[model samples]
Target: MASDVEDGVCFHCLQPIPHGVELSVAFQGDDKAVCCAGCQAVAETIIEHGLTAYYKHRDLDKPQQTPLLPEQLKELDVYDNPDVQSDFVRNTGDHSKQTTLTVNNITCGACAWLIERELAKTPGMIKSVVNVSNQRLHIEWDGSIIKLSDIIARLARIGYQALPFQQNQIEANINARRKGFIKRLGVAGLATMQVMMIAFALYFGVVSDLDPTTQQYLWVVSLVFATPVILYSGQPFYKSALKSIQAGSVNMDVPVSIALIGAYIASLYAVIIGRGEVYFESISMFTFFLLTGRFLELLAKEKALKFSTNRLTYMPNLAHREYDGGLEDIAAKQLKINDIIVIKPGETIPADGVLLSDKASVDESLLTGESRPVTKATGDGIVAGSVNQSATLRIKVTATAQQTVLAGIVAMQDAALADKPKVQKAIDHIAQYFVMTLLAIAAVTFLVWSWFDPDHALWVTLAVLVATCPCALSLAAPTSITGAVHRLNRMNVLVKGAQLLESVKHLDTVVFDKTGTLTYGQFKLIAREDYADIDTINAIVSGLEQRSEHPIAAALSQLSDQPISPDAIQNYPGQGILAEIAGTDYRLGRCEFIQIWHPNWQPKRQSNVILANRQAVLAEFQVDDEVREDSHDVICA
Candidate 1:
C-alpha cells in the first residue's frame, strides 16, 4: 500500500497530483503533499495568518465557505466545565483533580510564599506549590469541596495571572522575566560601582585633599546614583513585601524592604543636613549582589532543562479523527472516547485506544522500555505516545486526552510538588518567627539607643534590620533543593521535591531498584580488551549505541570521534543489537546474545558487553556503577 505522500494525493483536494510539482502543506506541525502551488500557499497562509476575509468576503456562489470565528473569550468559570478542564486537570484521587497552571507576575520567593499562604485558607485546596524559578503552580484540590475555577479566581485575587498549563508558557514566562530582570540588574550593577567609588572618598578619605565642601558634593552624587537603583531595580522587593503584608503575613522580603526603604530615607536625611552618615553604597551593593545571584540561578535552571517526555511533548497537537467513514484533521484535545482515529505509519498514536486495524507494528518505546517495535493486531490496546511503525492503523479510542497514561505521568509529576518535608516545614516556620522576633529586637535596640545616644538611633536600627534580614534562613530549603535538583537533572534524574532527598533520614527502611535507584544509572567504562582494532571497534560500537537510548549505550558513545553508520541495524531489547558494519556482520550485547555468532565466547565477569563477528569474540568491554553513597548504611539502619 502506498503512503498518502508517496501516492501523489493532494492534501488539499484529495485528487491525483502531479508527480514533479513538489508542493506541500503544513498540517498540525507535519508536512503533507499538495497537488499544486496555489492550493499549498493560500491554505497555509490562511492557517498561519488567521485570514478569514477570503471566506467571509466570498460571493454566495463560492459554496459558502465556513468563516473562521474567533475562539470565544472565556470567563474563568469555563474551566469548571469538564470539557475544558480535560486539558490541564487530571483525576488523581477518588474525589480530587490535580492541576498544573502557568502563573505570571511571580517575581520572588515571597510571592510564592504569599500564594501558598492565601490558598491554604481555601476549603478544597489539598496542596499548592508555586515554583518561583519558572512560575508554575502545581495544585491539587477535592472536586467535591471546590472547583478549579475557584482556584484560578483566588490566584487572580492575589495579584497573579494564571491559565491552564501550556507547553511553551513556562519558557515564555522565563524569557520575558529574564529580559526585564536584565535591565533592572544592569541599572543596579552600574549604579553600585559609581556609588561605591564616591563612598570610598567619603568613608576612608581616599583623596587626602578632599574637604568638607567637596565631601558634601560627593555624598550628594552618591545619593543621586543610588536613587534609581532603589526605586526601579528594587521594585520586586517592595511589591513582594507589600503583598505579604496585605495578606496579613511576613516574608523574607519584609526585612529586605524595610532595610532598603529605611536606609534610603536615612541617607536622604543625612545628605539634607550634611551632618550624618549614609549607606547609599550598601543599598546599591546589596541590590546588585542579590540580582546577580538570582540571575545565575535562573541560568542554571535553564540549563537543567526538563525531560520533555514526562509531558508527552512530542505528541502531535492534532490527530486524524475518523468521521462517518471519512477522516478529518482536528485538535487532539477535542478527541473523545470511542472516537475512531487513523494512525499512519510514522505518526504518533494520539490517545489510549484499542487497535481496529487488522495488523500493525508500533514502537512502544515510550510506554515500554523495549526499543524494538512490537507487533499488534485487532483489539490489542494501544497507547497515546507510541509511534506507528509499519502499517496504517485505525484505533477506537478508549480514553480521552486527560485519561491517557502519558497525562497520568504528567499528573504524577505535578503531585510531586504537593507538600514540604517535615524538617523543611519546621525550618520555614522558624524563619517566619525569626522575622517577627527580629523586628521587635530592632525596635527595642532603637529605643534604648535613643536614650543613650539620640544622634545615632536611626543608624543603629537600620544596621540591625539590614544585618539580620533573614533572607538566607528563609531561603535555605528552596535554594538547597534547586541547586541539587539542577545537578541531578543534568544526570537525567528528576527529583520530586525537597522531601525526596532531604527527608531520607526519616525512612526506617529503604528499598531501591538496582540499575537506576540503588546505584547511578550511568555505566562507567572499566576496559576494552582483545578488540580486532581499537579504532574499528570504537567506531562500530559508537555508531550503533549512539543511535540507541539504552543506559549502557551512553557509556561507549564517547569512544569514537564519529560513529560509523551501519546497514540492517536491529535492536533486540533484552538480548543485543545486530548490524552490518563495513560489509561485516557484528553483534554487541550480553555474552549469551553473542554466543550464536561465536559459540565458545564467554564473559570475563558476571556482566560484560561483548562484541563479536562470525568467528570469535572481537572485544569484551567491562562496565559497572558503584552503589550510591551510604546506600548500605541507610538501608541497614
Candidate 2:
C-alpha cells in the first residue's frame, strides 16, 4: 500500500501539500519527506543553519522501510568506503558474522510487514523481521555479498533510517518512554479532576436552587466539561475496550467501558427530559477512577512486557555471510538452514547452528539463566543469542530463523500472554452471574416496592441496576496482580503476565533442572600441579584441552595464558585425554588413572583427576562444583 504521508499534511512543518507535487525524499512512517530535491536541499540548509523546522514538519505516520536486498544494495558499495565500513563493522561486528542493528521510523504492524518483506527480496538474504513497537529491524545476510550501507540507503529511499543503538541509547529510550507515560497519566488525571468537580455541582442541584431557567445553563456547562474528559482522559480505555470486543473477547476494560457508557447515556436522557436528578456525579467519578487505574496498569504491564522480552531482544539483528570471498551484511531474520557465518568474541550467535571451527566457548546464560560458559566443539550445536566468550569461530546454520531456541522463548511469551489468568476467569464468571442477579434483583425490588409506592420502586430499581454492577469485583484481580507485577519488576523479576503471577501462587512442586539451574555451572581450576615446570604443564594442558568438550578440559584450557599445540591426541570418552607431548606419553583422567599407573598411589575421594606418564604418577588435580548461593534457600523456602 502507498504510505499515509500522501494523504496527510507534513507533521513537521504543518504545511498543506500542493497537488501534483512529487516527493523528492520519501518519508517513512516516522519521518518527514520534502516535496522536491530543492526542498530537501533547502531543508538540509535549514537544519545546518540550526533551525529544526525540518524536524517539526516531518510526517510521523511514515512507516519504517525495509533494508535493501543484496542486488539492490550493490548500488551503494558500502564495503569500498573505509570509514562507512569501519563504522558498520564496529557497531555490527565483523562483516563475516551476525550482529544486530536498531532502525528508527517503525510506526505500526504494517511497517513491520513491509520491512520484512522487502529484505527477503535480496539474494543470499536469509531473514528480516521488524519489531514495530521498538523500531528495530533484525537482518541476516551474507556480509561478503551485501553491504550494510547499501541496505540502509535503500531504506532511506523508502523514508526509514537504520541507526545502530549503543547500550546507553537503549537505556535512554526506555527512560523516555517512562517519562511519556507519566506525562500522559498526569494530563488524564488533571482532566478527570476538573470533570468530577463539574459533575458534583450538577448532581447536588447547586445551580437548580438558583433559578429554573438557570438549570439549563448548568446542564450545558456540565456537558461541555464532561465531553473532553470522556474523549481525551478516557480514550485509552475506549480504545482497549473496542479492541477487545473486535477480537471477540472481554478484558477488564470491557466492563468499565460498559459502565461508563451506560451511566452517561442514562444521565444524558434525564437531562434532555428535564429530569436532571440522575447520577452524573457517579458516572464522572467512576470514569476518573477507572482511567487512573488503567493508566497505572498500562505502565505496570509495559514494564512486565519489557522484562520478559528484554533478554530475547538482545540477539543480533544481522548476520554476515561470505559471498565470492567478500563480506556482506544481511538481516538476521533472513537466515536459513545451512548458511555459514562467522562469530567473534563477545558477539552473539545469530542462529541455532553447528560450529565449523575446532572449538569455542559461549555464555548460555541468556537462554538457561546459567552463568557458565559452555564449550562447543566442531559439529556441536550452538543456539542463537549465546555470547561467544573465547576466540572467533565459524558455524553453519542448522536451524531456520523461526525454529531457534530464542524463537521458542518468544513463542512462550506469546502463549503466556494469550492464556487468561485464573482470577480473570473467575471475574468473568462473576460478571455473567452478576448481570443475571442484578436483573432479577431490580425486577424483584420494583415488584415488591411497587405494591407500596410506584415512585419509590422506580428509584429503587435504578439504584439496584447502577450499584450492583461488577466493576469493583472485576477490578480486584487486575488491581492486585498489577500491584504485584510492579513490585516484582522493582526487584528485577519480570513476570510475563498476571496469569503467571497467579499461577505462581498455586504452584505446589518446583522442578529444578540439574545442570545449570541449582548449581553454579562454571568450571573452576581448583588446583594445578607441575611435574617439571608449572607453566609448561599449563601450556601442554591448554593445548590438549582445546580440542575436547569436557568441562574439566575447558577449565584447564582457560587457566593458561601461553599457547600450546597438542600432538597425537586420543580421546577416552567419559574419562579424559590421552596424548603425547614432547615425546612423553601421558594419560589424564579421573583418580582411577593414577591408581592404574602406580598401584601404591592412593586416589582422593573428591571429584579429582590424576595425570601420569608411562613411567610413574605425575600430578593430581582436585575440583569442586559448588551450588548456587540461593539454591538451598530457595529449596527450603
Candidate 3:
C-alpha cells in the first residue's frame, strides 16, 4: 500500500509528514522531515547540541512549542549594543544594570528554578528572581562583562524565550495561569466524584457480596480514573517538591507531593498484581481536596490584593498632550518631563507636574487623605492620581510615569508584599522543618509496621503521611488575616498587610482625620438671606457655581435643577466665579467678592455664599457642614 515516492515520517516524533512539507532539518548527518515547525526547531536544537539520542528515547506524545525561528532570534542580538539596550535596562553603580524580562515556556516552578540557577552561574550575574505569578524574571548583572544579549541567549539555550517585559504580556500570562488552574481543578473534581462512587459501593459491602473478580475489576476502573488526577492535576506539587529539594530546603508541598505520589504508585501496583487492598479512592480524594484548598487560597490572595491593583484605575489611559498648533491625544505613559498636558475638569491628572494655568482646585482625598479639594496656581506642583475638580489647567510634566508619587506608593506596597511579618516567617520556618520530620516518621513507621505485619505496612504508612500533613496548620494565620482584611475593607478601613493585625492587638490609641475621613466635607444649604423666587435664585446661583471648583461650589451647584450655563464666566483665584447670566452681571463668592457690589455686607460667622450684582446684594446662601452620623460614635468608641 506504500507509495514508491520518498515519503517519510518525522525523525523526532516519528509522525507522518505530508508531501510538500517545508519543515525539515539536518540531524546527525541525515536530512529528516519533521511534522511541523515546532518539531523542526526542537530537532535542530537537539542535533546542534549533539543530543540526537533524545530522538530515539523521547516520549512521542510529549508536547512541543512553536519557538521563534532563527531569523526572528537575530533581533535579540541588538541587545549586545549598550545604546540599544538602554531602553529596557537600568544602570546601577559598578557598571551594572538590572532588567525585568518576560520568559515564555515556564510551565512549572522547576523551570523558574532552572532559569535562576543558570543565570546565577553566569560570571557577571549578581542576582536573578522569577515571579511565577507574572512570569517575569528580574536580573541584575555587570554590563561590562555580560552583555544583555548573552543573558537572553543563555536562557534560550535552556529552551525558554526571553524578551523585555511588557504590561500587556504579563497580564496575558497571569490570565493563562488562572485558566490552567481552573481547568485542572475541574478535571480533578470530576475524577474524585467518579472514584468516590465506586469506593462507596465497595465500602457499603454491595461489591463485597460480588465475586473476587468483580471487585478487582472495580479497583482497576478506579485506578484508571485516578491516574490523570494524580499526574496532571497534581503536577505542580511534584515540580515544586523537586525545586525545594534542589534548593536544599523543604516546604509543605514536599510532604504533600510525596504522600500523593507514593500512595498512587502503591495503589497502582496493588491493582496490577490483584492481591492487595488498593488506595485508588484515597489518592483521588486527597488530590482533589488539596487542589481545591490551593485554588481557594489563590482566589483569596487575588481578593486581598484587589485594593492595590484597583488604584491603577485612577490614572487615565490617554491624555491630551500639547503638540504643534494643537493638542494630540496620546497614551499617558508616553508623557515625558517638560511636556505640557491639558487636563479638563473632572479628569484625573496623568503625572506629577507643575500647573501652568493661572489656577485650579484638585481633589486629592484619595492620594493625600485630605478631604478637601486643594487649590493650586501657576508654578505649584500638582500630583498625579488627583482629579481636576474645578477649572481646566495646563500642566508641565515634572516626572515620568515610573517616577510619579503614585508609582512610588505602588512600589512601596509591592515591597511590603515581598517582606514577611515576623509571625508569618516563624510559621513558614516551622512548616519547612515539619515536612522533614514528617518524612522521617513516615519511613520509620513503614519499617516498624513491616516487621509486625508486612501485608498492611503500606496502608499504615499512607495513613501516617496523610494524617500528619500540615496543610491546615500552615494555612491558619493567613486565612484568618485574609478574612479579617476583607471584613475591614467592607467597613471602609484599609489594612495594607497582615502585620497590621499584629499591630492592632497592641493598639492603645486611635486617631482620625476630619473632612471626608471622619466627617462629610461637603456643605448643606440651610438658609437664604432674602426670600426671592426660589426657582429664580436656584437657577442664578447654579450658573455662578458652575465656573468654580471649590468644594462649597460643588455643594451649591448640586442644589439646583436644570442649571443654566453662563453666557460668559471668569474666576478669581481662591475666590469664586464672575458670570453674566440672562444679560445681568452676577458675582458668587466669599464676603470680599460680595463687598465689591454691596459695601455694607459683612462676613457671617458661619459659612455663607453671597451673590451680588453692581447694584445690590441679590442673596446670601447660609451653609453648614453635614457631619457623618457615625463620626460621633466612632470618636467616642
Candidate 2: which stretches are off by over 4 Å? 1-220, 230-279, 413-417, 420-430, 436-466, 472-637
Error of 2 at 83 (Å): 32
Candidate 2 per-residue lDDT over residues 1-637, each given as its tens digit: 2233454343222233334443443244334554322234333434444444334443444422222222322443433344333222322234433334555434223334445556777665655555333445656566767766656665655545564433333433444445645665565566556666766665566645656566666666666666555666566556655654453333445445555665666657767887645555565666666555544544554454455354445777678876777667886756767888888666888888998888877888778766656877889999998988766778899864445777666544433433347766555456545655666776898799999986566566666665665656655554455456547656545466557775676888987765555766666656545456667666766777777655556666665788477668887544567888778888777766556667787654354766778796666666545567899898899
Q: In model 1, what are the clashing residue pairs, if there are any?
A: none
Total backbone clashes of model 1?
0
> Compared with the true structure, what per-residue lDDT tens digits does model 1 show for residues 1-637?
1122335555543344543556567665667776543345434555566543443343333221322111221232445667656766788779988877777766555667678887888999988887654567888899999987678778776767676775544554455567778999999999999999988777676547668788889989998999999999998788877876876777777877888899899889989999677889998998888778767766655554463334567677789997888999987878999899998757988899999988776877565434446778789999889887655689999876778887887677555643556655666668767888988998998999999999889888878887898767656566566566657756656566657887666867645556555665457776668658888888888898886645567788778997798987887654678898778888888888998876776777655788888877878888676568877875677
**Cα lDDT over the full model 3:** 0.69
Output the worst ten-in-a-row residue range by lDDT, candidate 1: 64-73
Q: Which candidate number maximizes TM-score?
A: 3
Per-model TM-score, in order, reads 0.69, 0.52, 0.75
List model 3 lDDT by residue over 10-125, tens digit each.
55444455445555688546567665443554455556556544455444454234233233334434455443443345555668776677776443334454677688899999
Each model's lDDT: 0.72, 0.58, 0.69
Q: What is the C-alpha RMSD of each candidate to the true structure, in Å?
A: 11.2, 13.6, 9.9
Q: How many backbone clashes does every candidate have? A: 0, 38, 0
